[model samples]
Target: MDHAHIITELGHANITRRMLATHYAVDSEDEQLVRHIRRLLNRGDLENWKQRVHALWVTERSGVLNDAILGDVVHDEAMEVRTHAMHLLAERKDWNKTQQNWVLLALHDDHPNVQRAAANALSLHPNENHIRPLIQVRETTPDNDPQWLYGMRLALRNQLRDEDSWHSLMGYDFSEIDAERIADVAMAIPSESAGDFLVWMASKHEVKEDSLLQFFRHAARYASREQLNNLAHLVPRKFPNKSELQLELFQSVRQGLLERGEGMSPSILNWGSQMVRQIMQKNITSGETWSYHTIDGVKNTPNPWFLQVRSSADGDRDSTFICSLPAGGESYTGILRSPIFKCPEQMSFHLAGHDGYPDNPRQKKNGLRLVDSISGQVLQEAYAPRNDTAQPYTWNLLEFTGRNVFLEIIDADEGAAYAWLALGRLKPEVIPFPELSPNEEGKRLVSAAQLAGELRLNQYIPNLKEWIVGPVPDASVSIAAAKALSRLDEANLPARLSDLLQHSGKLGTAITALRKAMIAETHTTQRALLSEMVGMLPLRYQQEVMNLLSNHATSTGWLVTQIKEGRLSPLTLRNQVAYSKMESVVSGDVKILLKEWKDSLPAPNHLLQDLIERRSEGFDFQNANLTNGRALFELACSQCHQIAGEGALIGPQLDGVASRGVARLIEDILAPSRNMDPAFQVYLITMADGEVISGMPRREQGNAFVLADASGQELTVNLSNIRTRNLVSQSLMPDNFDELFDDQQFTDLVGFLLHDSSH
Candidate 1:
């Protein structure tokens, strides 16, 4: 970090090192830093946009943007530069009058993202002057385009803090005032304006009944239960009752009942234990009355329907399919409501992201609450275990079954990390074959199985059977299923498991589990079952059978007991190392055994600790050749990481590698286990037949779990075929850099990674 070195790198031919040096220069106080890079921003060539971007980076840290540089950023030929500039502008609110017009011009920018950023910037400094241009933009914006996304609607809401302020919007066609305008648009419009808007629609506009009916459905969101009831009464009386209109009105009545926690049968709310299985069945849309609450002046409701949901059900979603967050950028500080239905024996839903803090009491940030309709008492409250993908959350409604209760999916927190609340349909029946796509549902399944067993929920016994007998359900699911059946005192479970020995594909997993749990002779039946099943393995699977026993083994003596004195059968196999068969690591009668024999081999070391001690200063980086570095990356790192767009994407792209700095990159390369990237963590999966494969987990494509190894080879494994998934501490990045390159080569590799040559 010498100032001369940082300055030199800023102007270096190696893009990576120059970027890294400029990054340091951003925080540098050397008065000459700005003078050194001013031309990079003002350079008029479109081909040199990346330099302009880097110049913007350095200047942004200086805490000033002159109009000329601002002009270059907003009107720069490259949309990338313009978008990046717009982002910087979005973060600024102190813009002068001329600067504000530039933002309004950005509102008309071609790219939606740039326009959104401009909109957000303007929304931060809402003023009456923003209205005309905003309306102009919305009028020309396509219906398919998220008109709300433009920030026009948002600025309108901010501008209209009261009904009197809504007059400017009066003459726009009623079509412009869509359902979302009624449902959300914030409390800035006032409750009275909602009524007035509806009156305007009725008296001045002759619209289709469907569009007219859409208003009631939307108003049902923020309107009170009493208001919904009032609308329910007025609809049938005032509107002519055509069949479709009558049906729509009937739907309103049901929605009103759900709002008040009245009507709806308790049985309709039931969810069975196959809930995970049911969720796995995928693509579920809840049939129950669901509503999203918009704002009421005091406690703000979200603008878009807060109660919108998407499940596996939405894969083929139309515009009508309700979604959470309206494209992940929109934030609503509100709640999505579940209808008031009589509680069935069990009720469940899928939840993902921050489950708010129940400890906050009134705020209960990001939480799900079940409340008694009449008493207004919180009957049972639960929050999702933190996750990004939907994890199944269930309520044992047995105690409250038949009672009128409703569910609330609430997000009262605005913190970026805390506001997410994604949910799926509320359901009653569990599916027979659930998907095993989620990497985090192990704990939930175990707990649910335990609860069912403790309650002797005989109804769930079938789900336990399916889970335990699956081709390759997670080991947690299998063990929990077995335990639940035993907890229910099902005498046939042992016989069923013993019979599954005939199932070489699925129960080979149970075979592995039975051996690990054999430290004590407590489960006599299972021990006998395992003793018999081990003999059932074919000779081709001898290595796998040995692995199944040795993998989880801790004590050698106890394992010997089960095979010898404990009524368990012993296996006869050839020992490859000693070239004899007396016995091995699972144990020897005496001398050479598998554990000790394996210990005799040389230990593998990648020199991670040694490099960590040496640190970034350990290598002589001055001799680095950027050309050699890129070539070396193409040979070594390109299989998983992309740089200059040439390599595979098994790991995070390294285009902005300079941003992470040299020290961080060295640690990541040599000591990846120190701080793992959750999204790119390597997972070791053991199949039921005991085949183990390791790779970086890719997104779940329905029922398939795709994993890519360091070689960039992809293995698509079905969820049902996986026995266990162990998130490995080590990364998919190859750890043999010390073996692969000498000190100079390693130094050059680091140098290349820290520079950008693309520009």
Candidate 2:
């Protein structure tokens, strides 16, 4: 609106038109219109208190507020007019002492908003008079009232210049009054000067220990990046001999910076390196020194109580233990994380309670995880056995000595019975690896392959050379073993490997291992790779595979008879027409054997129901071939399961099957998932590279998950490199029992489980 029309509206007899004119004049952004409205208010034409307040607003909005008019409105009997006047006064630096006293007196005003406005105004020109009323308002206002304190802070900002100023401003001599109260008031202020006062107070050894955490919290929220960096470097320099004070100050600053998203500062991290080595002995003073998290409704989360400091000999050499079992019966699952620190040469800890269950999948859920804080990968991990004692564990951190890392103590089991892992203090100390004889070199694939090449044990040459030709679970493992053999005796490796491949028994043994590894594999690509490895061995006339077929001894007895009588040259029996295929070839003694194998277990449900109903009935072991039963166990179960130390140890062991009775054994064969244990449940893992694997679950490294299929073949995959991880309800054991054995073979398998007492 034009100035003439706006002035007409302001002079209108109607109060509504006058108010509307005031609103338009304020927002019109026209300085001339605002001055004209100001003139109307000065002349008392706008008589309503609201109109006077709004006219004042229009003056300020258009950068034409008359200080004399605003000064007059400060006590206009209308709180809104006075409040707006006080706010405008607060922003002025040129207000005189009388004007300052006007604001200071408003600080004692009954209404909080007006008092705050006055307090804010007085902050710009605070004097001895402003301090008293500012403190009075602060004292009366709620402690949680942020605005009061913030306003009060401005009035107290000059007081935070140094230690003496703060003590004097607090009106108490440091020694005569409560040191605690001094700290209380000092820590509440947020600014670099306040930080300076805090540091200076620490220098005088006057900072109360009780208020230190709050001080740290205050600094974390408001301290500048430069101030925090100074707290790390300059504080230590000033207090060179006060290491304890230095550490506390450094850690406090370091933690504050982290919480503020000031990513880790190297100097700050270095200042705490020596202290991170003392978690067991030192107490955490910050709100959350460790990152505590939970799954499945875990309770009694990490606090001072969760981080328990024990007597040196309490748990057979303890200092501190991160206790997950807060109330002693919670089957809670949680991960306790330590602050990030550089890894020392070595770190050792102990587990004083159940870290895992024996031979159970829950065993995989509880353990300590040493994580790479930089890359977020798990370098290594360790697990305590299923015993309630202090089980010492030491991780070799030489590989990551200089890298920043944090440790996680995980207890993820929901079983109430002994369901916690009390992780002892992690101290940087060495624990050397125990010596293992070279005689152990070829006994296990993993240990052998890793140690043999490095140690160069010549005795492993025989086993390594045999594995080189083919039939190994992974072609890479075979290659590694071959390389290991070369390291042992490069001169004789090729000949030994060639000779081992040409032998039927050894070649068959290697091929058998490869096939079993294939059985444990769920991925077709991996299975196909194993199959191609099988072709590394040339088939014989009576292929070595003939002896390895699933329990054919009973049906093929006559073939041996025919061969012995010269009626059949079994070695040259090409008329039977053996042919090579990627899939396992199990030729029976007659055509019916192949037909029976083709229809193996078409409907597994019918067989499982029948076996469950009959229990152990109709089993005539008197006619059952005990010798053939052992052969059947080797053929079918050995690949994925173990019995009497003869078969692959990849899957669940079958040592206690005989005690389960005949009916249960029959049901187990037909219904693999009927009553499967969680330890044997399948986990499907998709890797970051898009490869997928299914296997039984095992302990997880912070950055990796270990998976072992029913065949007991295990693989540790990087957790950070995983795209997806899912728990499959089905057991890892395949559901094709009937396909692997016929009536006699099945009967013999049942006999092995039912009557073989030693198994």
Candidate 3:
């Protein structure tokens, strides 16, 4: 490697100096090589430097490379070079007595950077010689500084190969620091004394709280009961005395025993047994009941008895024993303990307890609430007040719809010690309605009720069965009945009850409902009601109903029958031709007979229908045909572009596009703008040096300075090192919309695109 080039790339600092020192020692050559190496050392750049200096050390200066770099590396003004040099010398084989001594001297260096380097160097050949010194450093150093402790432990870790190093290191004082360090030391101290070191550390009060807890958590991973019992005396004094904690410890130990029990011998059994017993003994003594009044109230029930948790620091770690019941028989043994913490102020706390159970008796008037136990963000509130009768109480079972459920039973009285608060997952209850009968009158009435919103036609046509039966006899006898049925269909019936009876016949009421659904002017909320009502109709009737409306002409013969049957009250045979014209526009089907049918129509025909037919027949003449192309182009294509600022960049600005010519423009639209601008070309390249780079071409001299991929990130590249560069061809526009527009709309859109906004 070009050492000068590498050094220049990285910044010149003390770190680089030490690295150079180590490299020189490793690349032990003649005086000529040394002078050349010294030149690189003179310049000061080591910013983006990386990789091991092994090439210089192992190949060039292998013979002369001892730990000579240690002296300058430790005291180097640049912290980075000192760190690198120390690490370099650590693996060098000439780590003799003198070199070891030098490494130890560097351990006491004031800067943690220096100490870290020395520690790493010493750990390279970890043995018994370094343990005592490491322990000495650890004992005198402040444990709060992680670097110091980390380095000490690192140096000692590899040296702890046997019992001697392990036992020797365990005798030092590590009490004042933290649990993490204690655990680190214990882990290093032969696996045999892992339990012993933890127990001893636990016995000392000087260990920090989090550290001690962390040590137990670590020990729990490997140590068993007998090993744990060896440390039991240390645990009870440190941990808060709670039944839950005791239970958790017991369960963890039990699990550990089961997992590793086969390897355990009888000698370890006694410690395990004793630890379990002691923990269980503490649990038994921790429970105690005390009394307190609900509040200073008129009905002061002083029967409240709560378990006073004696071992915890917070006074609120108390549980009130509401009630208990037998698990298997009439004799009750199960204890019902609820967490009832005393807030700093006079405020009521919610409790979770059941009213009563067949086997487990419930505690009356229970309430429970889960608040930010730490910061007090009240999550849920639940209570069941005394319910003497089944009157609907103001209970918000589910709050905020689905987020949480609040089971509240309000007494509405001045004071209540609302008890229960058990938090679990919430499940919603869905109630299913009963099915309707098939009587025509009943079905129509039900349909009318169902369709009473916007689709009031639902009231008239209950289902396919009634629809097949045809309109009721004497349907339009009175306008009052006609309008009453209409109002019911549209959900707009008057307040009077007798008014609903006027529109009683099946078909008359059904037609009234359908009229309300199709033509009634009503509220928007009611409009959705019509769509929903339409959905309730039998699926088979939907097609028939639409067919009746669509066949406005006598084409289906149904319209003629409706007129003869007096059902076509809205239009007469002579005027129905107007609807036939709409049919021609909507459906472009023209036959020989249909052509003759159109010739007999009224002279002043609708303008739009005539245009639809004319546009349909222009395919025979030429590839291009137009009548009012400019008007068509304006209507279809002005939204997305501007040749000179009138269109949107939803596509590219096209002012200079006329230069590309119509043929290329046509190809661009047919294809798309996928080709990258030469200035904007992006490349994916991996260098021989193993650096991966990709970016847009910012500057392309001999070496390209890619601004970076627009979608990716920026990175520089020497053109020579790049392995890959290619342009991709494919427009990003969707290509499957050929059939979306009519021939005119398509033609119009294309014309507007070609004709500049300047035109």
Q: All candidates' TM-scores? A: 0.30, 0.32, 0.33
Name the best candidate (by TM-score).
3
Ranking by TM-score: 3, 2, 1
Q: Could you tell me how far off, in angstroms, the CA of residue 570 lies in candidate 2 after the best superposition?
A: 45
User: lDDT of candidate 3 vs native?
Assistant: 0.39
| Tens-place lDDT digits, model 1, residues 1-759 | 564455455556678976786677776676576755655456653245566666676777776547787776788777767877877776775777887888889878888877777777777776667766766666655666675454667765675555455576666454534533533454334455554455344444454676655565444433444455455455544554232354444444344334433442322112222233332332222323343343222223223333343433324221121223544433445555555677778877666655444343334466678888789889877764455556667788788888887766666554444456665655763221122212123344555566566446776666665555442213445556666776575333242232233233344565554433322224566555555555555433332333233322222233344444523323322212111212322334333443453345444233456665575767555778877887688667877888877678888887877777677887787766567677887777767755456678876753567788655767567677788888756677655455567777778888888776333
Question: How would you encode candidate 2's per-residue C-alpha lDDT over 369-461 as one tens digit per residue?
Answer: 888987889988776456666666777778788888777777776566766767665576322111221112112243344345544455555
User: With candidate 1 superimposed using the best TM-score fit, by how many Å does residue 108's alpha carbon deviate from the native?
Assistant: 2.3
User: Which RMSD does model 1 reach against the true structure?
Assistant: 24.7
Better candidate number, 1 or 2, judged by TM-score? 2
What are the root-mean-square deviations of the candidates from the true structure over C-alphas? 24.7, 22.1, 27.3
Q: How many residue pairs of model 3 clash at the backbone? A: 51
